[model samples]
Target: MNQQLPLLFPNAISLTIKREDLIHPFVSGNKFRKLKYNLLQAETQQYKTLLTFGGAFSNHIAAVAYAGKEKGFKTIGIIRGDELGSKISENPTLSFAENCGMQLEFISREEYRLKSELSFIENLKAKFGDFYLIPEGGTNALAIKGCQEILTPEDAEFDYICCSIGTGGTISGIINSALPHQKVLGFPALKGDFLKEEIRSFVNKENWELLTDYHFGGYGKVNEVLIGFINSFYQKNKIPLDPIYTGKMVFGVIDLIQKNFFPAQSKILLIHTGGIQGIQGMNMKLRNKKLPIIEIND
Candidate 1:
């Protein structure tokens, strides 16, 4: 479930990556860590089906759908947005989830806002009884338990740990697992607008710091600079990084390094939270830009 990949710029300073992105094909990356316990709990409760909510291009939805299909559980994705009806190709995430055997239920944003209410759960249960419901990004206590296991095996002590922030589940788990001596930096994929307060509310750790500038545009948004950095990274390390999550976090980390935020000799570990399906959509959007395509040249 992990891989030891050397830092591309390693020198006197020690840098390592916890390659959780390579964990499983369907249950890939941080999503796998976050969902492991939830799945187990579902099985323990004898749940025959799983239901979750997310937006159009949510990595959580994709992971859950694929995992459910592979594990032989019925899955439903309560997606936020109107159904495009026969226009499935318009959104790659929706297309992939359907192909993976997930039942898609589209709802308006207004309906999605009532997601956490008991009334909503009761209504859903009345229609689809006894199904296990996993919150978006699997940010529950059980999920955190699975993510905590990610940091336990590392023998080398790091001065700092960095990871991209989505629902803050992974960062919360990392911060909770980190030693008192280590600092955790979260580069949020969402804008700083309310993310700082959101993360703080989740894990009230003294050593955690949220960097808001790296979000490029916003969630699922990218620009020329991010595309360029993603291209350069693959060229240098031959590691594929999707632009939405890990690429943005890596971009932020490099900028921090250049800013001398940490001493040159600082040992750091960065978590690669995979979102490879995100690349398919991003590539389609960037296809017209003539961005340096990361094709095998040899």
Candidate 2:
């Protein structure tokens, strides 16, 4: 469905959202896209086990776990932050993954940083005995190939395609599939322009740009302003957005509208890459900090 948000955009401009979040309850949006080809490749390779990495409340972790279970593949999640090992019961994402039969193994943050290194992967292969390894954020070539299917011929009507950036995989696909007349805009959930190089590595197109000023601190960081915007947007649009990714992108898109970033009468399509699963874990942090929690309908 193309959901228009006239209230959020300037009078002459049109803003609509592609509800990719509604694609599936668990493996929604880019997670589903990122995993589709990966899972198929694993099956083709006759790999019975799927292994990936993530943080305490990574959407990728939860998606991979459930996808593996549904596909009849044993799953393993190499989690960052060894402290999270004993606290799985307290984390909604980790707990959900565990409930889906994903084996949870926690390692130090330092070790997590070497996840892409050959030696670390070799160590994991030796320890786990040969599994299909999906990198954190699920941004491999197959993942990008899956994400490329997000935009269809119907989407050609839009002048701009906007999406939240996590590992740059989703936006890369959008950039690749976007019409030549459309400019794809990405709002990074993290604070940096480094993703430009990462995204460029995946696509041959130059029709996209990153909005770096709206991260609201960085990945996994949120404040009252962002929280309020998300809550209010949900109340108005009846569309719940996760604070980490979609919420920040929506916030930036609206702010840019107010700032006159787009030309008058521009048609914008915002890709709602799913991350709602992280809200429960994020709410836990908010409650602990005595901050306002993001409100979502049951």
Q: Give the TM-score of candidate 2.
A: 0.98
Kindly list the per-residue Cα lDDT of model 1 for residues 1-298, writing each as its tens digit.
Answer: 3343455443356556777777887678888998898999889999989999988778889999998987889998888876643556787888988898998888788988998899998998998777999997778888777877778655347888889988878888888888888999999888865766665766667888888899988988888788788887778767778788888998988887777788877888888888876777677667767654433222
TM-score of 1: 0.90
Q: Provide the lowest-lDDT 10-residue window in model 1.
A: 289-298
Model 1, position 150: C-alpha lDDT score: 74
Estimate, for each residue in 1-298, the C-alpha lDDT of model 2 and write its tens digit.
Answer: 6788747456688888998999998999899999999999999999999999999999999999999999999999999999998998889999999999999999999999999999999999999999998989999899999999999999988999999999999998888888899999999999879999999899998898888999999999999999999999899889999999999998998889898888999998999998998999999999999999998975
TM-score per candidate = 0.90, 0.98
Please list the residue runs of candidate 1 whose C-alpha ends up more than 4 Å from where it truly belongs after superposition. 1-12, 201-204, 288-298
lDDT of each: 0.80, 0.92
